[model samples]
Target chain A: MHKKNKPIIVLLFLLPALVLFIGILIWPIIASVHHSLYQYPTFSDPGEFVGFKNYIDLFNKQYDFGKAVINALILAALSVFIQLPLALGLALMLGKGIKGERFYLSVYFTPVLISAVVIGMLWEKIYNPIYGIVVKGAAALNMSDVIPPEGLLGNPKTALLAVFIPTIWQYVGYHMLLMYAGIKGVSPELREAAMLDGATDGQVNRYVIIPIIKPIIKISIIFAITGSLKSYDLIKVFAKDAYDCSYKVPSLLLVRYAFHNAGGIASAIAVIMIIMCFGFAILVNWMFKERDLYGKK
Target chain B: MAKSNEISFDSEMYSVKKTNKFVSALIYVGLVVWLLIDLFPLYYLFTFSLKSTEEITGTNVIGLPKEWLWSNYLRVFKIGKKVGASQVRLFFANGGLERSFANSILVAGLTILICLVAALMATYAITRIVWKGAQTLNSIFMLGITIPMHVALYPIYVSFSKMGILKSYWSLIIPYAAFSLSMAIMVCTGFMNDIPKELDESACIDGCGTWGTFTNIICPLMKPALATMGIYIFLQCWNEFMFASVFSDEAHYTLPVFVSNLKGSNITDWGLVGAGLVLATFPMLLVYVFMSRKIQESFMVGAVKG
Candidate 1:
């Protein structure tokens, strides 16, 4: 290990990652931005330079990129407000050292491990118009008049909510597992002290455990919002065709345009999605900073 | 006066304990209900996969099948066979399921291997090796963590098409490895940082070069983190649909893509669709069942740090 060769060794060790990172992640993002400015229809032909026209076209009725953005935002909101609270509740409950904790933890986390396609397929069956459990249960309960017989996923009015349930459900366990780990790491001494001072379980969780795991919660919020914005696979399974489906997310629209040979429009959508993801991430960090409980400078 | 105060306090404490027991019971009941909600879908999927088409479509959807058609699993693997007069069953009509399964294995395996080697080296350098610009390099890699994959999709597709590698496994492998590198580096680096610097110093004193120290001392110590990253990487590569769908043609379709295509083509055949879902889900399920703790720990470690 000569001192002279140390820098070379570092370079040698880092070359593969640097190459792949630049080639796959960095270059594509740069190329996406560049392509977004041009009216390139195909790879061979660069076509005319369109500047911001592609971005403008995205908002027009023909492209409906605005709708896609709205849909993703709606999903992001639901993830933050609904999905995360559910996960926090579960984490707190499980964090209390319940019986069969290990078993419960594994059961809850199983969905995160399974492929979204599989979960989507399974849910699709459960939402089937004819023989689905929803229909059957509604009938058996004599509440068929209320529940949609044509399947919730097929109905334009309920499709977004229907599609989002599984999306939200699939990740509840993921966030739960994260919060659970943080909860577990909270010192037993703090909890004991709180209890000794006559703090109830709820109070201890609220004042002690929750505050201690604020950073983890903040991270979860970022993941939830960003992941919701970039969501595709499970939504894809339900949507099938992006334009045709009632629930259209940005990724679906991006893929649709890419395949339709509208490369510029697709790239524009890509750039917008990237900006939104990054913007949301920064927003979350700023929000967390404003509410920093530790008061660190 | 002191005795009376103690008596009142004891009575109040006893009442609080009674309510606590009731609250505990309520919590247990709530947990049980959630557990059922979580497990029911999987159970239904399994049972539905084993049911006959008639049974599945019948009014008795909730009931257990009278005769479990275990052959549905067999039928999924079988290609080009007519089940009934009106229905023609073909699982992998043109190198469908089996080919896609092999492709998934190859892609996932390669991604994990490449990602590990590259991430391992980069992590060792960034964390263990003291360098001038190491922190800057680390920050750059960290930036990759938040960049949405969609931003990379269109460009990668165009470039690969231009290079005439759009339909090959390289298209999928390279991006999978690349996109996954950030988290992989983060996890490995966290683990590598935990290995006492004293060990590296001792190894250096014992005539071990940087490469030798990394290989003999650091690599073995990184096994747990490596395993965790391996599982996470494998899951990501296997279940990755966005890049695989866009990049790979039918001949090179991975399992997720194949399964998706199967669902679309066989929209009417619930049994076959169930079988396809089962096929796609089983491998990951097995991995989870065996390595649940490691996966949880790794995910937490990566997530908490972020």
Candidate 2:
């Protein structure tokens, strides 16, 4: 019933979102790329064109972008190896038509609903050296000497791990829910057939259910990796204004540079983050697709 | 021989059943343990919020407050009050808790409104309209999902400062709504697909134009989707910190930034900080309680970077 010349109406409807998207999101990315190539001491100052000097300088001690990149990579590794496995285990268990399934699902998801700042603050209190539960528990167990005088978050060896603990904990339910939904989508007939073939529950999950939910698992891995790389709030909460901390991620540096008249460095960090996120996402997708092809062959 | 085989099968079945029970029991134990880990911090936060500074610092760290002091919450509310400042004067001060609460609500509310209206129209244009470049336009918006907002921070700051909207609420609202549009359009498109195209055709037959059809037909039908998207947008805007912190001044601080700064600016009043955390989380907790299923579904729709 609609003809072609109703273009005005379509344009009217699309204009607001398109303008906002281009202005706020797309154009700034272009601006960031442009800004990263120069000696942008401040937003207004657009200094001499440094030509990727900022990018190269990132690896130096001044910026230490390489270390932050490595820290973020370590977090991505932990998410894929440890966090995803735990989430998968919970997803598999919960997928088995468990009792109080809804209750468990909702309860597990509570942490995800709460703000990261709150989670970070809670952990800060929990790791407080003098009054924290961790120290108190250690003292109660006669392991007072084991815990350093400077608490878990204070110790260089443990601070990154300490910061990551809550970060990983907060999102286990998110990945679990994604996997749970995927598991639920597996036809019951498939499970029943496997059981009738004398397969135990573990065997069925290993050989049948796991294969069926591989796509979800792939997506989970991508999300886990990208999410870890983009992680800011929880880590920032733990490492407040301490730019020299061992647990610095790309984001902390980005914000610090943006404010400290180092716009070029900040833009360089932002570009690298975007690249790494897109890279990992594509890499995971490709890895999963290749494996699927091999399996099919 | 047949009878002997039958006996062996029966015994095997019995053992399998017994182990299944044990395994299920173990699963329950694991789930319960994780559940406690999940809930303990929140429980501790609530109890900690009510504890005296003495109890929190010295005697009881994890237990319920010896005396439930609701005054900690009141103290958090009365944060900006000085010895000489009048009540009404301090109430309007940026340091007061209520100002952040108002800021957060106004930012979140405007973000939700802008996202819904803009995304709804855009989704209709892409999904329902028979335009030549609709598919191209849709993919362009989808690309926004992959690009993290960090890349835009410096540029946004620059632009906002240049445009002189750096400290205004629009600084937050515009960017938030813009970023949220991708997810909103994604959700709206999903819902728009399920709505049979016949509605638009039938509406045309009934003498309704494009605007009339959207307003009278599609908008009403998209209510559930809109609500789900609104909630997601609300969660994002309310909990956002980095941009809110950078963009806004003291008087314009959102709840997350406010809660985060609460401990830093003061002389470490643990109870008051706890109270502020509770107050920051209360709205989200209420949303979770009432609309958990919708929230989960919303997460599923935008789960990848949500």
Name the top lDDT candidate.
2
Model 2 interface CAPRI class: medium
Predictions' DockQ, in order? 0.56, 0.54
Best by DockQ: 1
Segments in model 1 whose C-alpha atoms lie over 4 Å from true places:
A1-3, A290-297, B1-19, B79-94
Q: What lDDT does the true structure give each of the candidates?
A: 0.84, 0.85
Candidate 2 C-alpha lDDT tens digits along B57-172: 87888888999989989888876545467778776676567888888889999999998999999999999988789999898898787788777889999988989999889999
Error of 1 at B76 (Å): 1.2
DockQ of 2: 0.54
lDDT of 2 by residue, A234-268 (tens): 88888856488889999999999998988998998
| A129-174 per-residue lDDT for model 1 (tens digits) | 8888888878889988876767899888888898889876689999
Q: Considering summed lDDT, which 10 consecutive residues are worst modelled in model 1 chain A?
A: A288-297
lDDT of 1 by residue, B218-237 (tens): 99999988888888888788
Q: Model 1, chain B: what is the TM-score?
A: 0.85
Model 1 residue A236 lDDT score = 88
